[model samples]
Target: MEKCSGTTKATSKKRNASSTEASLPDCKKLKSKDGGKTSSNKVQNKEKTKMEKVSSKKKHKFLGSTEVSQSSKHASKKKIQDGWLEVTKNDKGQLLFKDFPQFQPNMSPKEVLQAGSFGGTYFRPIYSSVTKQHCEDEWKELPEDWLKGLNVPTQVASSTYRDRVNTYKVKCGGSLEMWESSGWIVTQDPYGWFQWYCRFYQGRRTKDDERQIGRWAKCAGVKGRWRNNLITKVVRSGCGFDNPTVSPVVRQTLQHWGYRLTKEDYKEGAKRVKPK
Candidate 1:
C-alpha cells in the first residue's frame, strides 16, 4: 500500500510539469506576436509620414508655377501700351529715365540725347535761340584775341551772338524749370528723318492707327489722314517723348538695374493694355 501511494504522487508531479512546459511555449509565442505587431505598426506610420511630406512639396511647387505664369502674362499685357512710361527722379534730383529700355546708367546727357536720336528724339538746349540781328553786332565786336581764346567755331560763335540779342524777345527763359514745366524742349533724332518716317508712319500705321481711329476719327478717309498726321508728329517729337515697346529682355534688364516693377503695376498695366 505504501509503494502504491508513492507511485501515485510521482505520477501527479510528472503531469503537472508536463502541463507547465506546454503553457510556457504559448506564453513565449504571445510575446513574439505582440513584438511583431508593434514593429509592423511603426513601419506603416513612417511610410504614411513620408507620403504626406511628398504631397506637401508637390502642392508648393504647383503654387509657385502658377504664380510665375500669372506674372508673365501681366508683363506681356502692360508692355504693349502707349504712355506707360514710368519716370522717376534719382537722389541727385536728376531725371533717371524709367520705362526706357534703351537708356542705361552712367550715360552723359549728351550721350543720352545721341542714343535717343535713333528713336526720333534729340536733346535740345535749355537756352533759347538768339536772333540774327544781335548775333551780327554783339558777336562781331568781340576782340579777335578773345574769339581765338574761345576756340569755338565761327558759326557757333555767331549764333551765340544772335542769341544774346534776341534773348528778350523769347517767351520763356532758357532754364531747366521752363523746359520741365512746358515739355517743349527735345533731343535730336539719330536715325535721320527717313528712319522716323519708316517707324512712325510705315510700321506703326495699321495697328496703332486703327486703335486711334476708333477713338478720334469720324470717317475712314479722315482716320487715314489723321493717322498720317499723327505719325508725322510722332516722328518730329523724337526720343524721351517717343512711344517705345517694352520687351522681355528690357524688363529683365530693368530688374537687374534695381528697378523692381511691382505686381500691382503689372496688374494695372494689364488692365490698361489688354494684350492678346
Candidate 2:
C-alpha cells in the first residue's frame, strides 16, 4: 500500500507470507519437437528473462525516487494576494467567495483546525505513497497562527488517531489510500482534499483548483449530496438541528472537508430531504 497521507499511514509491520517468495520458479518447460536439452535451456533462459522483467517493474513502481515528486516540477507558482489568507464569512456562517460562487464551505481551514478535525492525525509524519517521500513536517507549511494553541503531538501530528481530538469527539476513519486511488489525491496534495483546501485558502491557485472545488461542491456545497444526507438523518431521527448526538460521524467528516454544519446550513439542507 502507498503511504497513507491521511489517517491511513503505512505501517512497518512484518510482511505476510507473500514477502518470502522472491525467487523466479520455473514451473514447466516448453518441449521442442525432439525434446532436446539445448531448447530446454533456451526456454528456461526466456522464462527467467520474463520473470526478471516483471520483478524489476514491480520494484520501480513502488520505489520511485522522492526527489521527482517532492521537488516537483509541477509546483504551483506563488501568487500571494493582498489578503492572501483573509477570510470573510457572511453573518450566517457562509463563506463568501466572489470568484467561485459554486464553492461554499462554512468553515475556514483555520476554524477546522481550531475546532478539532482529522483526529489530530491529519498531518502526522507519513511516508507518502503518492510522493514517495517520508513526509512528517509538511504541516509546518500552514500559517503559524492557525496552529497557535494546538498541540502538535495530539492535535497536529499524532501517529495514532485519538477520537477525543476531533470536534465531535467521535471516531472517524477516513482512509487515505481509498481516496488517493479514486483520483481525489492529486500529486499537488498527497494528504488528500483538506490539504488542498489549506493551500487554496493560502491564496495558491494551481491546476488542481477546479477539481478540488468540485469535490467540495459534491461534499459540502449548497446542494452537496453529503450535506443533504446529513440533513435527512437529522430530520429522520427527530433531533434538533444543533444536536451533536445526531450523525456525529457525518459532522466530523464535514469538518474534515473544511465545513461546519451551521443552523443555516441545516435549515437549508432540510429542504433537500422529504418527510420520509
Candidate 3:
C-alpha cells in the first residue's frame, strides 16, 4: 500500500476494484520553510557513482514489456524533428520554460510511464488553474496505447498513488506537504518532478532544466547517492538486480526518475563501487 503524509493520507487505504470515487483534498494545499535552488534533498547528499568493483553479475528484469502498438500510424506522427528546439506553451496555454540542457536525459518520458513508475499516479491530472485541466492534450501526442489503464483526472488526494499500478506493487513517497515544505514544488510543473521531466523529454526546454537534471543526476547519475547505496548495500546484499525485495522503495523511486534499474546498471555500478 502507498504511504504518504498530508493530502495523500486518505489514499493510504487499499482500494478495491469496485471502489467508488472517494473525496480528495485540494492539490494546492501544502507547506514550506526554507527556500532553495534545488528541487529536493535527493540532490543535496553526496551519493555515489556507477559500479566499479563487483563483476559478472546476472541480468535483472525490473521493467514490464512494451509491445509494439497496433496504432502504428498515430505513433509515427509524433516524431520529433532534428535541429528543431523551441518550447512554446503547454496544453493549458501557459508559457512554458525557456532554456536548454547541456546534455540529454538518459531515458524517455513515455518509457518511464510504460514501465510503471509513480504507481501510475505521476500523470494523473490535478486541477489546472488556467484551463481547469492541465496538459491533457499532450497525452494525445503520445502513442495512444501507452496512455492506457491510468486513472485520469485522478482524485487530487487519496487516489493519486495506486500501488497496484506500480510495477513493484509497493508504495514509497512523501506527501505533497513534505515536498512543498522542502521547496520542491514548482508552479510550472504543478504535479512536481515527473511532470517537469515529461515536458523536458518532449523538448520543452526551460530554465529549470539544469536544476531538475542536476537533481536527477544526484539521484541516479554516476555520483548519485541513491545509486551508491544501491550498489553498496542493496546489490552487495546478494539480492541481485532482479530482486525487487532487495530495496523495493529505492527501486520504485528510481523508476519514477526515468531509470529502469537493470542487471547491466548493477554491473556498471558494481564496477565503480568495488573496493580496492
Compare the candidates by lDDT and give the number of the best one: 2
Which sections of candidate 2 miss by over 4 Å? Answer: 1-85
Overall lDDT per candidate, in order of appearance: 0.31, 0.72, 0.54
lDDT of 1 by residue, 1-276 (tens): 899999999999999988887777443434445545554456668999999897666544442331212233233222222212234455533334332322222322222222221111111122423211111122222224323433233222222322222212222123434533454322221212221222222111222323322322221122233323333333344422123332322322222122223333333333433223
- Report the error of model 3 at residue 168, Å: 0.7
Q: What is the TM-score of each candidate against the true structure?
A: 0.14, 0.69, 0.54
RMSD of each predicted structure: 29.3, 23.7, 27.4
| Cα distance off (Å), candidate 3, residue 251 | 0.5
The best-first sequence of candidates by lDDT reads 2, 3, 1
Which model, 2 or 3, shows the larger TM-score?
A: 2
| Candidate 1 lowest-lDDT run of ten | 117-126
Stretches of model 3 off by over 4 angstroms after superposition: 1-106, 125-145, 149-160, 272-276
> Candidate 2, residues 1-276: lDDT per residue as tens digits?
344643243232323333434332333333355644456577779999999897666445433322222343223222222126456777876777666666778888889999998889988887767867776676877778889999988898888898999988998755877776766676667888888788677655556677789888888877777778788998899899778898899888888887777787788778768886
Judge candidate 1 against the unseen true structure and give its global Cα lDDT, from 0 to 1.
Answer: 0.31
